[model samples]
Target: PDPTRAESKTVKTTCPYCGVGCGVLATLTDTPTGPQVTVKGDPDHPANKGRLCSKGSALAETLSLDGRLLHPTISGAQASWESALSQVASRFKQTIEAHGPDSVAFYVSGQLLTEDYYVANKLMKGFIGSANIDTNSRLCMASSVAGHKRAFGTDTVPGQYEDLEQADLIVLVGSNLAWCHPVLYQRIAAAKSARPAMKIINIDPRRTASSDLADLHLALTPGSDVALFNHLLTTIHEMGAVDSAFVAQHVDGFDAALSAASSGEVQATGLSANELAEFTRAWIGTEKVVTIYSQGVNQSTSGSDKVNAILNCHLATGRIGRPGMGPFSVTGQPNAMGGREVGGLANMMACHLDLENAGHRATVRDFWQAPTLPEAAGLKAVDMFRAVGDGRIKALWVMCTNPVVSMPEADRVKAAIANCDFVVVSDMYGDTDTAKLADIVLPATGWGEKTGTVTNSERCISRQRPFLPAPGTARHDWDVLAEVGRRMGWQAEFAYESPAEILREYATLSGLAAQHGKDFDISALSDLTEVEYDALPPQHWPLTKERRGGRFFADGRFFTPSGRANMLPLHHRAPAKPADATHPFILNTGRIRDQWHTMSRSGLAPRLNQHMAEPYLEIHPTDATTLGLQAADLAEVSSAHGRAILRVLLSDKVKPGAVFAPMHWTSQLSSAGRIDAVVAAEVDPVSGQPESKATPVAITKLPAR
Candidate 1:
C-alpha cells in the first residue's frame, strides 16, 4: 500500500436523494488508510446554483459501509453470485410457468438511475412478458402523472425552473417548498426580494415555515384544494379573464368544465366566497402566474380531478408554456421525472409511450428488439400489494425502497411480503424494514459511488458520475439486474460492461420512439459513445442535436391525437375519509423540513433531527381545548386501518377540524410512531396514489393506565 500523502480528485454527479436534483462536486481523497469523498454544490448547475440543502449537503457522510449489504445473502448465509442469480431466475421462471406472468412482480424505486429503471422495466415487462412491475414513485407522484396525462395530453411538465423566478404570482398549492424543495424555494425567495411587487400565495392547511414567506397564506381546510381551485376557475371566468380565442383554438371540453366550476357547485367545497373571490382576482389579475402544486393536490381520491381543476384556470387564460405561467408539479423523488421518461410506471412504456395502446407497445417492443412485450397495463402501487396479499403474486423483487415503512396500511404490506413465496431486496442499507423480509439481499452502490443520469422536476437530465469505487462487493443496480437477466436466459440482450453502455442502448431506444410524438425522446444522444455518454453535459430532453435546452409546450403543440391539450371536466369531491361525528378530526400527513422518506439517510444526521425530534400530532388550539388535551400531551390517533399514540402540539396552524402529522417516521425510529401504519390505504382511483395526506381519525387524551 502507498504510505505517502494521498491524492484527491473531484467527480461531478447529481444528488440521488430528492427531486431538487442539486449537482454535486464529489472530491475523492486517498488517505493513508483508504479513499474518502467530500461533496459540495456544483455552482454551475442550473437547478441549485452553488447551493445544496441539508440532505444533499450530507451526501458524503452517508456513503460509509455501516450496515451495508456487501454481497448476496440467501437464508442469512453468504452465497456465490452464480447461485444467487440462478436461484432468482429459476424461481421467477418456475413461478411464471406455474401461475402465469401476473404471478410475479418487480417493485423498484425512485432512487434508482434511469438506466436501472429501464433495465428493471425491461426485465418484467419485456422479458417476463408481465406488466407486474411498479416503483416506489407509485407512492409519491402517480397522481401527478395521471393528472398531467388528462390535462396536457401527455404526462408532461410544461414549464422550466426559471418560470418560478419570472412569475408575477407564484402560488404553492399543497407544497412546502422551503423545506421539501429547499433550493427551489430559496430561488423564489430571492426572486421575491429582488422584485418586491411580486406576490406569493401558500394554500396549504398547515402554516409551515414555507408559509412564512407568503404574502397571502390561506390556511384552508384539509382536502379542500379542488374546491378552492374550482371556485377560482369560476371567479376567473366571471371576471372576464377567460381567453376565449385560445380556448377555441387549442383546447376542448371547456363548456362542461365551466359548468362544473360554477358558484353553486363550488360552494360545497367549504371555502368562503369572499376568500375565493380575492384569490381568483389575484391569480387572474397577475398575467404571469406560475401555480406550483405537489403531493397535497396529487395524493387524493380525486387527485387527477384536483390537477385538472388547477389546469383549467391556466388553460382558460392561455397562461401555460410562457414565462412565469403553467401548472407545475414539483416531484418528490430525484429521478421521478427520469422514471417517467423511461416509463417506470406500470401503465407506461418506454419514452412516454402508453402500455394500453397497441401501436405504442409494438413500437417499444421493436425498439428494444425484445421478442415479446407485455401488452396490457399492470397492477399499480396499491393493487400490486393487494395482488401479493391475495396470493396472486408469488415472487417480488424490491429495489432501493422500504415500502414496509412508507406505504399506507404499512403493517399489512409487511405481512404481504412476509407471506409471499419469494422476495429479493437490493439496497445499500441492510436494516431497512423492506430488507428485513427478503429471502435474499443483494448489495448495491449508493449515491457518490454510482454513475448514471437523473432528470429533475424541470426535465433537466444531468450525468451522475462515480466519485469512489464500489465499496465491498456491491455493484451498480443495473449491473446486478442485467446479470440476473443473463442468468434468466436473456444473455445477449442483457450484456453490458458498464452503465454508460446501458444508457447508450436506452438512448437509442428513446431515439427510435422520438420518431413518434412522445415527450421523452432522447434522439440527441443516440450517437454518443460510452466516453461521450459518461462525460455528457447537462441537457433537457426531446433533446435533438439541433435543439438544446428549452421549455415544453411553447408552440402549443401537444402529443394528444388532436395535437391539442385537453380541458378535463372535474368537480369537487371530498377526501375518501373526512372528519365526521365518530372520527371528528382530519389527519393531514406531509414531510418536515429536515428528513426525507423513511429516515434512511436524513436520520443519519443528528442535526437534522433537531428540527422536530420525534413524531407529534399538530392540532388546532381550539380542538385541543375541546378534546381536553394540552401542548405536549400524549394523544391516540386511530383510523379504520390502524392506530398510533403521538404527542400533541397545539397550534392555530390547523383548522378547527383538522390535525397534522409528518410522514417521515417509521417503526424503526419509534415503536408507536409509524404514521402510515395508522393511515388508511384509500388511494386515488385513476392515479393509484394513496391518499396519505388526509385520513379521518379520532383523537383523545391518553389515559394514565
Candidate 2:
C-alpha cells in the first residue's frame, strides 16, 4: 500500500549473498498478507549502481520463517534460552576440563557477520584457551590468504573493484564471474562495452557461461593452471615486460623465482601453441592487466603455488598496486574479507594479526585481557573434523555453516559428527545436514533481522542493518555468543550491549595493531556512536586522520618487515589424486546461476530453485556415449570415498574426460544427488582447502529397481 515516508521505513543494508556486497535499500510496507519488505539496489552505493543479480533480487522469497528453527532445542526437545546456554557452557567446560582446551573447538562460517565471528573467535581462542577455531572459509579462501601472506608479508588485497573497469585486459582463471558474481560481471561487461578495446580471457577446463564474453578461451587441463602461469612469468621476461627498477626497489628473490619458473611448456597445458602464444602476447603487451581468480585456483593441492605463480607474473612486471593492474582474488562469500579481518581462520588473530608471531599474540592477549591464549596455530577445517572422528576433539560447536553437505568426503564428516560426544549447532534452520546431528540447536536471526558490519572483496566496510523484527524466539548469533561468554565467566570482555559496541572494540583493536605496524587500520571509526554506526556509509579501508581514502603501495611502500615484498619460487605440482583406471573421469563441482553452497537458505527460494530444478551431472557427449548414458538417464558417480546418483546432462562445455556438477544439493533437498559425497578430502598442503574441483570419480548408468 502506498504510504507516507514516515509510515514506510527504508533501511540501507548490504547483500548477504556473494562478496560483491552490493548495497540494498529495504523498504518495509504493509501488504495484504503482512508487513512485507521490498529490496532494491541503492544507487548511492559505489560497488553496484542500482544493479542486483538474480539471487540478490529474489532474497525476499527466502526471508519467510516457514522452516525456521524459532526456538532453542536440546536433544530434540524445545528448551529455554537459559537452559540451552547453561548446557552449552557446562558441556564445553566439562570437555575442556577432562581433556585439554583443544578438546573443544568452534567451527564457524563465512555467512556469519563480522561481529558474530569476532565473539566466536574471542570465546574460543581467548577464554576457552584453544586455537581450534576455524571457519568454513577454510574450504574457500584459505589458500589465497596463505599466498597473500607469503607475497605481501600480510593478507592484503591491493586492488579495488574499480580496477576491473580501468584495466585494458581482464584475465579470469578458474572463475565463472558471470554466475557466481554477476553484479561485478555486469560492471566489467559495461566497462568493456563502453571502451570496446578492453579484452577478457577465460581459462578453465570447461567452457562456462562466463566464456561467452571472453575474447580468448583456454580450455586447459583441470590442474594445469600453475604450468600456464609459470610460462607467463617466463614470457614476461622474454618480452622485456619485466620492470627491473620496480623489482629491484620493492621486491626480493627475483633470480630464484625466475630460475624456478624458467621451465614451462604449452603442451603440458593441453592447449594449442597458438592459443598459448596469443594469451602470452596479450598479457605481456597490456600495461593495465588484472588477473582475477576464485575457488577453482584455490581448491587444488598446489593452490597456494598457483596463486604465487599468478602473482609472480604481476610482481615481475610490477603490474600490481597500480590503477588497473594486479592479481585479484574475488572472494566467494559476502564477508569472507571481514572474517579475515576478525581472524576467523584457525591460524590468524584479529586485525590481520599473525597466529604464529609471539609479539602479535602478546598484543591480542594484552588487549583482550585473555589469560589462556593458544601459543601456536591449531587444526584447520579438514584436520579439525579428523580430530573429531579420532576422539581428540570432544565438544564441537558449529555455527552458520552446513559442513555435512559442504565438506569434502562429506559422508565421513557426517559419520564423524555422529560419533562425536557433544555437538552444538547455531543456525536459522534446524533441518540442515549438520544440525540434525547436533546435541544442542539454537535459533539464530537471518539477514534482514540482524545488524552488523561486513567488509566486502574491496575492503569496503558496509553496514548490514536490521529492518525487520527478529522472528519468534530467534536471537542474533553474536548475542548468543556473548551470552555464552558471560555464562563462561568473561562478562567484562563480552559485555557488548549492541553490535555497535563490538564494532567499536574491534576498531579499537585495529588501532592497537597499527601501533605494531600492521596494514589494517580503521581505528578512526572506533569513536563512532551508535547512531553513526547505524548510519555508517560504505567507506574503503586505511581511513585515518593522517592518511584518508588512499590505496596501498601506490607510493612504492609495502607492509613487509623490510618494506619489500617477497617473490617466492614456485613449482607446478599435480593434484594429490589423479584419475585412475577405475575412476576414469574427473568430477568438477561448482555453483549454478542460482543456488548456493549446500542450498541451506537458497533452496527455500522458489525462484532460485526454478533455475536449477534438480541436481544433474554435466558430462561431455563423448563420455556419455562411452558410458551408454543418454540425457535424462540417472547415473551413479562414485569415488574411493563415496557415491552419488544424479540425472545426466550431456553438454559440450566440459572436456571429454571431465564432468561437471553443481555443489548445491544435499540429502535433505535431493536424495539422488549429493556432490560432496563423491568429493575427496585431499586438501592443499599449505592452505588445507579441499580439492573440490578435481575429484576423480567413475560414472555409470543406474538401473531401475
Candidate 3:
C-alpha cells in the first residue's frame, strides 16, 4: 500500500460488448497518477478461449471516470440520492393513482444484469400492477423470441456455440458475423481452416466482409428471407430429405407447412434459378447444417415469419438440437438472453412463462408476495413511445439504454420522452440522447465496478465480477431499483442487500416456473452461498439436478403441451414500406466493425474510433454516380420519419438501389450522424419488433454550406 508503488491484480469477468460473451482477465494497477487497467481474453472460458475482439481488447480504455455520471440529479440540478429517489417514487405513485397503473412505464435495456432486470420486472409488474415494462431488447430479438415460442412452445435456443464449428455447412442469413460478433467469426474461421471441407453460405442483401469466407453469397432481395427459406424447404421435401420418423413423432403441422412452402414465390428472392438450385442442393444434401441469423432477420416487418420459415426447414429435416445443427438466432447484446429469462419484454412472464396466461400471473404474484399482477400484455417499444407521445403514458423510467438514439423513429421517441410528465434515466453517462431529457438522472455503476450475472445467446450463465472501486457516488442498478421499490412501500419484497440475494430469489422462483413445465429452470443454483456465488463459473441453462448443461430437444421432446414442436405454415411478406418513386432506395442500418450501439463506452477508446472515425453511408458506386455523389461527399438521407447528413463511401458491397450505414453515431459524437432518426417505425404485427433494416429512403448530395 505504499504511495507511488505499482500494485496490480487480475480479475475474471465477462466482456460487455456482444452476445459472444468472451471472458476477460482485467489487470488493474494502481499508479502514482491513477489506477490503470489492461485486459486480455480468459483462456479457461468456453465461449471464446483467449479471444478478444477489437472492442473487448479496448474495454480498459472505456473504464475511465472522465465523463461518468457520479451522482444523482433532479431537473438538471445536483441532488442527493434520497431526494431523487423520493421524487421519482412519489411522482410515479401520483401518476399511477391518478391515471391507473397503465399510465406509468419502465423502459429497460438488455445491457442490464439479470439481477437488475429481475428487480425492475418484479417492482413494475408484481407490485406496481402494470405490464407496461419493455426493453430495447424488443428492438433486437423479440421476433426470435416470438418465433421460438411459436415453434417450440417456449423461448428456447436448441443448440450451443460449439454447433457453429461442428456443422459441415454453416448458413448465415442476414448476419455479418465477421464484424458484429468477431470472436464467433474467428472461431468459425479457425474451424474452417482446420477443416477445409466445411462450407459457409452468407445470405444477405449486401456482400459483407463475412462473405469472404463464404462458399456461396446470396444477395437476395431485402425482406424476402421467407421466400428463400420456403424454397429451401420445398427442395428438402422434393429431394426426400425430410426425416419422416422425426416429423411424425416430434413435429406438428408438417403437411400444412409443406403445402405453404410449395406455393411460395421463389422469384421474390431475387436470385436466379441456378443460384437457388445451388443453395437448395447444398442445404438439403448436407446432413449437418446451422442457419444463423441476426438483426437483419429480426429487424424486418416479416421478421417472425422469416424466423419460422427457417425453422420449418430445420424441423422438416430434423437438423436441430444435435452436435452440429440447428436454427440459431445470434443476439446483438451481451445480456439480451438474460433479459428474456427474467421476462424483460413486455409480453413475457419471468422464466419463459406467458404474460397472458392467468396461471403464470398467479404463480409470479404469489412467489413475489405482490398485491397484484397484469393479466394482459403491455405496450412494446414502438407502441410505448407512441403512448408517451399521445398522452397515454404519463411517467416513464428508462434504464441502461439510449432509446432516443437507438429506437426506430428515434426523433419522435426523443420528442415523446422530452414531453413526458416524469422521466428517470439510470445510466453511467449523463449526456446520452435519452438521459439529457430525464427529470431525474441516477448514477449507475458500469462494467468494471458492477457485479452480477448475464446469460449469453447460447443460454450460458456467466458472472461479471467487480474489479474496481465504484467511482464517486454511483451505485449498482439493482441497488438503486430495490431502494426505489422499498421507498414505494414494498419493503419486504424489495429488501435485497446484494446481487447474490436477488439471484438466489430469482433462481428459487424459477423452480415454480419449472414445476409448471417451463424450459428455463435454474433451481440447482438457488441455494448458493455468498462464497459459492462469487466463484460461480460459466454454465449453460437448465441448470437443475436432472440436466445441468446441454442442448435441448435432441430426444424429440419439446416444451409444448402436445409434446411436439409446431412448424408454422408461413408465406412471403414484403417490407412494411417498399421503395417507390419518391423514395427509390432501401436504407439498411447496422453495426460497424469497431463500434457498439450508440458508442457510449466504445467511443471512449481512441484506437477503436480510428478504425471507423465517422459515420458513412455505403452506397454502390453506380448509385453514387447516378446521384452525383463522391466518396467523402456529404449526402442527405431522408425517410418519412426524419433525415440525417452522412459522408458517402461508394462501394459495390451493397446493391445498386440499396445503401448501408452504421447505427452507432449520436448527437454528442457527430453533428448529424444519427441514422436511426431516418428509420421508419413499422413493426411486425406478431412480435412488435421495428423494421430497422428496410426503410424506404431518398438520398441526395448536400450542397456546399
Candidate 4:
C-alpha cells in the first residue's frame, strides 16, 4: 500500500448507542504498540453529516476485550459452544414439551442487530409457535408504536431527519436532545442559527439542556402531557387552525377526539394561563411545525394516550409526511426502530404485521415457511418477568440486555431470573446481573465486530459493518440464534449462511408484505448480491424507485383499511401509583449524557466516566431542605417496591416534590444506586410499557454515612 493510503482501511457502520443512527467510519491502522482503530462520523451519511457526540467519539475505547466473555460458559465456568447451545436447546425443548410452548420465552434487546432480532422473533413466534419473545425496547418506544398503529392503521414514522431542519417551529416534549441525542440537537441549533426566524418550544417537567434553545419552556406537571396536548388540540380548533379540508378528506373520528380534548382541563397540565396561551399562539402561528418526543412521553402508564394527544394536534392541523411537518418520535436505542420493523414486540409480526389479524399472521408464516404460528400476543417485558417469577416461563433466554438492572421493580426481576429453572444469557460481558444468574452464557460479538443493519428513529436503515475481527471464541448473535434454530429442527428456515442472506430473506419477506398492501417494503433491494450487501448504503424503507427519498404520507394516504388516518379518542390518566404522605417525592429515572443501558458498553470507556463518576439524585433545594439533606449528602430513598442509597445533589432543575436519578448504574458499578430497584412495575394498559418515571418514594439524609 502507498504511504498516503496506509491510513485508508475503513468500514462504514452505524453507531450502537442512540436512535440517531449516526453513520460511523471505523478506520484501522497498525502501530508499533499494537493495532489501533479510530471512529469518525461518516460524512456521506445523512443523519449527522460528519458529526459525533462525546459518547460516539469514545466508542473505540469501549470496544476493548477486557473482561469480555470470550467463550460460552455454564455457571461462570468455561464450556464448549456446542455443549452450551445444545443444553439451551434441549432445556427449552423439554420445558415446552412438558409445560407447553408458552412456558418458554425469549427476552431479547434492542442492542441486537436487525438480523439478530429477526431470527429471534422468527424462532419464538413462528417455529416455536408462540409470541413469547419481547425485547427491552418495549420499555423504550412501544407507546409510539401503539399510538402510530391506532392512528395511522400501522406503525410508521412519516418524516425524515431533514424535517427538523426544514421545520419553522420545533416543539420538543419530554426529551433532552442536548444530552441524549447531541448530534441531532446540534443540527437543530445549526438550523436555528441559519434561519433565525425558526422558533422552538420545550415541554417537560424539568428544565433540561434542551430547554436552553427553546423560545418557550413549559415545565408542566409529570404525567400531564395528555392534558397539555389535549388543551392544544382544543385551542387549535378554537383558533381555526384545524385543517378543515384535510379533516373532511382523509381523517376519521374527529368529532369524538375533539370532544375528548375539549373535556380535558388545561389547568391539569400545571401551566399558567399565560404559558398556555403562548404555546397555543406558537402552534397556531407556525405553518411548518415538527413535534419531537422521547422517553419522557413513552415511559408512563398513559404513554400511549400521551403519544396520541401529540399526534391529534399534528393530524388535525394536516401537518404530516411533508418537510417540516409531522409528529416525530426519537427512540432511545440504536435499533428500537429496527426491532419494530422485525416484530420484536410481543403483539406484532414481522414487517409491521399485526398478530391479531389472521391474514397478516398467515402472510408472515407462509413467508417464513413456518409449520406453526402464534395467534395471540404474548408476555410483555414486565409481564414476562412476572411470568418467570410465577414459574409460567420455565425456560428463558435473555440476549444482549440486562433486565435485572434495567427493568422496573428490578430487584424482583433479578430474583426471578435466579430462580428460573433454566436461564440463558448471550452478551459480550459475563458479569451483568442477568448473566450472573444464567445457567448458560453465550459469548457474542460487540459493535465493532458485528455485521448487520440497524434502523434509526427516522426509519433509515444503515449497515453496521464489522471493521475488526471477533474477539476470542465469540460469534455474532445472529449466528448463535441461527445455529440454535437448526438444532431445534428448523433447519431450512434458519439456514442462513451469512448476515447478507438473512437480510435478503427479510427484505424479500418485506416485499411480500408490501404486495399485500402493507406499508413495509424494501423489495427493490431484494436482489442484491454479496458485494451489493457489503456496499449497502443507508436507505429509508417502503423503498421503491418512486420512494427514493424514503418519505411516507405525501399523498395523505395511510395504510389503514380505509386508506384514512384514524384519530383516537384519548383522555388523560394519572400515573398508576401516586405519591402520598409516606412516599411523597416522585422518583424519576433516566439516562445521563455519557452512559448507555446498564453501562455494559459505555462503562468500559473510562473517559465516559469523567462526566459523572458516580450516580446521584437530582433533588430540588426545597426537597433537599425538607429531607435534611445537603449537596453530596448520602440519602436513602425508599419506595413501595424497593430502596436505594444515592448521593444527593440539590438543584432547582427538579420540581420541588420530585427528584431524578440515572437508570444506567448497575449492581456491578454501584452497591446501591440502581434506581430501577424501586421503580414500580406499573405498565400502560394499551402499550404495556412500564412507568419508569414518576415512582413515588421518600428520601431521608443518611446521617453522614
Best of the candidates, lDDT? 3
lDDT per residue for candidate 1 within 389-454, as digits (tens), equals 889999999998988988899888989999999999998877688888889888888877788899
- Model 1 whole-model lDDT (C-alpha atoms): 0.85
Q: Using TM-score as the measure, which candidate wins?
A: 3
lDDT of 4 by residue, 1-705 (tens): 554444547888999999999999998886555678899999999999999999999999987878999999998899999899899888888888899999999998888999999999999999999999999999998999999999998899999999999999999999999999999999999999999999999998998889899999999999999999999999999988899999889999899999988885777788999999999998889989999999999999999999999988888999988888889999999999999999999999999988988888888878888888888999999999999999999999999999989999998999999999999999999988889999999999999899889999998889998888898899998899999999988888898999889888888898888866788887777788999989989988867645754578889998898999988787888888889999999998888899988898899899999999898999999878877888999999889889898988889988899899999999888999888999999999999999998899989889863
lDDT of model 4, residue 14 = 90
| Runs with alpha carbons beyond 4 Å of true place in candidate 2 | 1-6
Candidate lDDT scores, in order, read 0.85, 0.90, 0.94, 0.90
Question: Using Cα atoms with residue i matched to residue i, what is each candidate's TM-score against the true structure?
Answer: 0.97, 0.98, 0.99, 0.98
| Alpha-carbon lDDT of model 3 | 0.94
Clashing pairs in 2: none
Instruction: Quote the positional error of residue 586 for candidate 1 in Å.
Output: 1.2
As a whole number from 0 to 100, the lDDT of residue 399 in candidate 1 is 92
Q: Per-residue alpha-carbon lDDT of model 2 for 261-341, expressed as tens digits?
A: 886644668888899999999999999999999988998888998898898888889999899989999999999999999
Q: Over 4 Å off in model 3, which ranges?
A: 1-5
Candidate 3 clash pair list: none
Q: In model 1, where do residues sit more than 4 Å from their true spots? A: 1-6, 32-36, 703-705
